[model samples]
Target: MSKPSYSKGLVGVIAGESAICTVGTGQGLNYRGYNVNDLAEHSTFEEVSHLLLYGHLPNKRQLEQYIRRLANFRQLSTAMRAVLEQLPGSSHPMDIMRTAASVMGSFEPEDENPNNEKQRNNQWECGDRLIAIFGPALLYWYQYHKNGTKIETRTGPNDTVAQNFVKLLLQTDNPDPNMVRAVDVSLILYAEHDFAASTFGAIVTTSTLSDVYSSVCTAIGTLRGPLHGGANEAAYRLISQFKTPDEAEQGLLKLLKEKKIVMGFGHRVYRKGDPRSPIVRDWARKLSEIINTPYAKNLYAVAERMEQVMMREKKMFTNLDFYASIVYHFCHIPTDFFTPVFVIARTSGWVSHIIEQRQDNKLMRPISIYTGPDPAKTPYVPIDKRLERSKL
Candidate 1:
């Protein structure tokens, strides 16, 4: 037998590759057989989510009913809103999202019904709870501090999450359809990737037969780090530090000389190009035209130019985070709230992966290659002359 092997990330383990379609590959992503692109282009977020959890895209009639169910679910219970209000406005966006997810669990915990419709139904409710409450949880805390007014997210039209979110957040019934479309496709594109670290963390939690809420909570905590979903927020912050392409290029050269990463430049996957980049870049370009901000236009140009320089200097292309930063900014996402918005879109992908992992379950436990001393003998110290561990 071969000697036991150890790898830190299990990065290429191919834990389970779905026959599901993909986008970076030119084909649209389908959960089992239905396309998420088709759903985003033609169907509602509710319908797409239902397809993932239920194993088939809904028919027209089924979709209609699904939309109504999601509409009802959009209203966060009074307690959830209250919880959001209690959180300090200064809390990290991920902290706020994870707290909302964990506390909402107390309001709607999944029932124990393995491999059955009831379990699926409960998971759907939990899914609805997340999609529904995210904006409210985010905005309630945001507006309360920014404008000192209590905001309500229950007030959007019966339509797509993208459309409804724009309407609710902007407090306008008439939002540009193209803007909504941009948001919809962004959700679709980020919806799933094969076992990113955060997805694996969700799988590990759910693999324990933990409730759906627990799994989601665990996933959000992991995603809050800079190496994962939080990278977009870091990317925006990095871009904002430079006022012009020349400045950014100079700063990046300095960082490279010091052997530091320029956030949003490289990816753990996609060696040559990230397929998702062009899609979001188009959206960012369109939104720059629509929002008509000089900074927005300048920022986009600077980022693209920087990407070109990095390719020449460091041989790295812009990844999803690069374009996602500018697009999300033009979408009215505050720099600090970038990752929270990511949590909103990525919840669909995260939960779907969690469900899929449990269906064909395995413990994700991995061995570590230890390099420390095998075992140092403990030395005795006088109790009367005790020293603190830090001092020692």
Candidate 2:
């Protein structure tokens, strides 16, 4: 019997072993028992970090200290800063992040002893290291090339991730309060998804007994492509290319006529629609208002209409990428840094999957029915004898 083709998107098929969270009817995504939408409103990114790491939301006292922990753990090792400073300033932000994460693993390994008391402390520190320094590491290396001048990352201790990141990037302590809130909400929106392609990529990496940094680096690299996390950047590019929804619609129709795929228009999972669309979309809309960008307004209109049209025409619904593009754009994120922010948020899920995979670690090598030439045949080609095949 021939292999049956999947319904094009692995929509309902089990692609691999996953004890990580799962998405189900209505595109509902949860980690453990906590709903993602609820968490986005009620919790900060730091609290969500606690949830993913400790398996539950912290109570009042626990949460207070946990917040303190995140704040206190914000400093980067001097060596790490030095390393970031020394990197050839002309590197891609994602490359800089991946390199920094890997190097951080070398310098800061988490507690490996399964039963060690230091495990909790070590894990928290490790996460704080990633969360706290990721922006500084990328921006420091970035500005070194752009300006040939070193940038100071600390803005005299901004408390929140968004605030600190803005201060670090802008070299100013006076980050807008609303801007920080929006960026923080964006991080919450992106923090976790149930076994997304790149998160699965992280799980598979950890299943090989690799370190967390390596697993996260792998996830980042995997997310940097158009088929996955790169869709946000692609969506931004597409919107930027067109001046209005009318133009975007015309371009989209032309492309569809030519049988070309539109970036961020559809998804493999959401046959009906991505439930996250309205949530993230509204945030972008609000931020567009706050930021006062004509591009944001036009992009929002274009994306909404495109989603409506694509659903009517192709039956493929908009996924997280569509709205995420507008939100990232509103956040003033560089197009290239699109997926790195994704990496920052999704690291929690990556760590969760890493822990899950380690629970019963097994190599994820799947077997296929061998249908190629059998091993018994001995076929050798002489180097001088070649067949000249005509191009079709």
Candidate 3:
């Protein structure tokens, strides 16, 4: 009866409402009304996860109890360990994360509750369990397949998520305090962004009344794409190719001339700039200074040169992933494991969105304006009479 309006990629579409985190809100990013700067400056990953899950920052006693609870949940079940052992080292780490989330769901199944009350509560616990165990699960697979070491998942009862992750990955009881803080701040910064691609994917799955694990698995799959969570890995690969800042400038200039799309340079929502970038960029610089190796120093320089070139050429600013790769590099993390780290941190946000979706249930179905052959002209033909279309 009337021409239907269409917005490609759903750009500028208000898909839903959320109060979880605000991006480009003039005062900078906030989680549950707390500024990201304050959270990054002062809060641990455990505290931020608590804020995302329980809707408030924890007091000292509450934080201690929460930490203990998460610690207690860190141990993987026998089946989980077996599954991790079977996964080959050739598998992508993000695939490992996806498989681990699905496997955890099987071992700890959520009962289907029509009322959703029991299921919702179970999801909260499931979220906490996954947050606690994801690092252990991932590193266990990594070490076992890499060199036949069945690494322990639990580093300490009191260790924060960042500490446990670093300790386990590095296989050291004593990790660099600066490295630990960098990881902690990265986790906080990456913990949530309102309706990001992966979060929205999780929300879409949740709208179908799926289990929390399935929803998180959906999120993981969505994040595995290069345009989303994989950007850091790609960005790191780009930075690693250059040995000097001047070389980096020339290489990046060539890339721009070739009309290549650089990863981790801009954002869809933050036209002004990504606030999260500078915070992690500072960490990258700090860690580079501490590492002081030629590679570390050179990588930081190359990254900075690339940032400057991107800004000068396209007026685009670096997003969180560009410099995050540098931070992870200084921490001795493998390039491929970069996005898996993203999964571990963003699990808190995924679970929060799942919980919120359950609170306000909807099918999330949107109509599309179809463009096809007219039904009257292209009536259903009998199979015997159908003609094959010509190749383009």
Candidate 4:
């Protein structure tokens, strides 16, 4: 062989196929052939989730039933609640999600036989149940630790997923309608991305015919990495450090001059620009208007200045996380919970990929180029005979 080629990080490599989402076409993102911008503008998170999971946008009747089904599945079992209460308060929310997911699987597992259709239906139900209750599970733990009380997680049947999440997190039944809409849009935008690192990790797990919860847990752990799903929290911390756009501009410029890494400006895909950024930026602006606070307006201005500076200086574009930070902040969500929120939205994509992987399953093993010395040339030494050639 002349040489074995490898793409580090699998950059621009086609590791597998997916019918769920298309990314970086320079046109925009699409979930199951529908444009993400359209979905974000016109569809609820539940609807987009249905599209991703079941492979089509539901009609009025279907959507009504789908929303009802998701609402019905939103309650956590007593065992699950007990498990959440036992986790340490200092644990990262992502870890909480990973543990919660694994715990849920233990409570309700798929059928043991892989060849049975019941197993597939069980997996699908598990996917829905997890997505439906993730917010409740996370918020229950959050409130128990923060307030020393167990907050009721079920808001009402009338509440949407985004609305319920905001309500439960803030411990209020009533929230700003505009904020609710902004959150719904954000969830839709984050719902699916084709073969994102976490999604790929889920696919790998599912390819081994593992349970859906195991796949989701694997994706959660993968997303917990700073490089992957934690960018929004990092971006929020950066923008929140400034008092005004001028201070933000100066601080950003200083960091840029010092060649420090910025977390949320660029993306691995979407070289021209992230198509989702503009849509989310608009929502962020609308949220800023709705909140109409000095801090909200200042933060929005800071984010804009950062975007402009990064583009002008680095020729980089704002990714979804940049504007998402502003939207989540205006909604009063904690920065630490940002990545966990990502896991909530992205569970749809993860479970969808898991189902897809199992439909045409194959182990995701890839070959590596060997660089070590030949085994024959290396002799194993017995513990008694081994001795150091030199002593320090």
Candidate 5:
């Protein structure tokens, strides 16, 4: 056989085709051929979710109907709520998301027939339902643990996904409109990125013709790693440790001198810079200004200083997670809940990719070149023989 080409971490490997979202294209990221910038600036998170899931931006009547449909699905079944309530308080919020998705699957199992038209349509509805309810599920568990109360999941029918999340999370009837807008835009920015780790994980599960919920559960687990969706939380922790921009600059330099990896400063795909960074940075700046607290101001300053130091010393650019740290902070979202919010937005992308993968169904099985002892020649030694060999 010819020598097998190796790419560590599958870097630069084109594993499959997708039309859901495009990343690192020369013009920047696009979802369903709609530029990310346009979507973030002019659209709501609900609109973006609809665009991503349904394959086109909805007109006025369609959008209103879609929003109502999503709102209707936001309530969790009693059994699902019971599952969330019983999860240990010490559990990582991402784990709560994983368990919640999996449990929801049991309550509402997808049809097993991958080729069934009705089952396919049911998958799309399941995707939408997950996108709508994940926020409520997360907040229900969060409040149940923190406050020892079962807060209502259905805040209202008029709230957008972003608005509903903030309201449910903070237990407030009215949140700051700017804060709501900031969170919404962040959701829009995060709604999709082509073939990201979590999306790929979801795709791999779906390629086996698995249920959509199982695919999303796979995505949540994949995103829990520090190298992926957890980076924002890591970035926030790093930025919060310093009180001043100078201190942040000094701290970053020391870490770099020691050859430590910075959590949010690099990307696997975007060498020029993450196109989403500037947009989120703008929101971070706005939130800092609006809060106008010494701590908020300091955090934003520290983040900026870190970005400058990373670029100056290492020629590395900030990714979305870098500025997103500051944005989530100003929204008053807890540090631990950062990646769960990521899961909520990314559900749209993950489900869309899962559906796309099913359309061009292929089992994503790749062969690995063997480097160990020859399979035919290798013999299994008994425990006694292995022990004797070690002794000799």
Candidate 6:
């Protein structure tokens, strides 16, 4: 008999089909058939979230009602706030998001009946509720730790998620419109990608018929890895080490000589380039000009030089995280909070995947090729009879 072909890391494996997104073999990303670029240019994150979770983009009245629903979901319960308080002040913001989602499930558990329409609607509601609260919970925990003040999470009722996030982070009622728009665009860009590591994790959990919160928790844990969602934070640290474009080029060349892994230069998919990178790069440039601090101005130049060097040297392109770090810095977001913001944006897509998996539930159990000693040749050994590697 012929041995089946094996692909490491599941590369080129067709795990399953998803109607939620198109990536990896596309001109650009699409969420439910809407081009990501068009959504970034013309749609709010709320509208995009609605489009992803509820199928079609909401009409004006429908959008109004949806926003109102999200606004109501923003306030954290006393128990939820207490959980945040108990978490160490030094905890990573991603940890806070994970804990917040778990606590939310305890409060508003997913309905038990997967086959019922109301239960499905309940899952949808949970997704929205998560989107509404992630930023608030993160900011509330942030303010408490940074200032020793238990800040209010609820802001203006009409505020979009981006506006609410800025309001909470800056502790101001009126956030800069440009900053809000930048964040909104970033959220839209980050909202979904087909079968990303974290999204796949969510699907795997849901395939087992796990609850929505479990699936989201699984996704969050997967995204917390540095190679995955931490790229933006890593990219920022890399760029900030240099003061000028020339310095950046020299530094990068040296790092490349050492074979150091650049954090935000390439993608596993997207051979041409990340479509989202340039959009966020434009935002970074615009914000840099507006802010015009010495560091802010220098940052963009250094980043561009780095991009040029990478492409010229290695034929790699900048992914979204490279310029996104600059945009967040100009907006005054703390470096450590970068991945948490990713969690906030990505929760929409994670929940969507969870719901989609539940609709046609199947346990995800893939077989791995055996590489260890053959079972027939290596029978189970008694504890006292097993030889140590040194003896072997």
Against the true structure, what is every candidate's RMSD?
A: 3.4, 3.4, 1.7, 2.1, 2.1, 1.9
Q: What's the TM for model 3? A: 0.96
Clashing pairs in 5: none
Ranking 1 against 4 by TM-score, winner: 4
Quantify all predictions' global Cα lDDT against the true fold.
0.73, 0.73, 0.90, 0.87, 0.88, 0.90
TM-score of each: 0.87, 0.87, 0.96, 0.96, 0.96, 0.96
Candidates 1 and 6 compared by TM-score, better number = 6
The C-alpha stretches of model 4 lying farther than 4 A from their native spots are: 1-3, 116-119, 388-392
Badly placed stretches (over 4 Å) of model 5 are 1-3, 114-119, 388-392
Q: After superposition, how far is residue 51 of candidate 1 from its true place, in Å?
A: 3.6
Q: How close to the true structure is residue 377 of candidate 1, measured as C-alpha lDDT?
A: 57
Q: Please report how far candidate 3 places residue 249 from its true position, in Å.
A: 1.1
Residue pairs clashing, model 6: none
The regions of model 6 sitting more than 4 angstroms off are 1-3, 114-121, 386-392
TM-score head-to-head 2 vs 6, winner: 6
lDDT of 2 by residue, 99-190 (tens): 88887888887667657322333654676668767877777776777777677665543277777776666666677776677677777767
Model 6 TM-score, all chains together: 0.96
Candidate 4 per-residue C-alpha lDDT over 1-392 given as tens digits, one digit per residue, 9 for 90 to 100: 67688898999899877888889876578988999888888889989988888889999998888888888887888999899999999998988999889888898886556465224767778888889889989999999999998887777776788988999887787888888898898899899999999999998888777888888988998998878899999989998898888898899889989999887888898888898999999999988887788877878998999898889889999999989988998888999888988988999889888888877777899888898888999899899998778874
lDDT of 5 by residue, 213-294 (tens): 9899999999999899999999888888888999999999999899998889889999899989999999999988988988
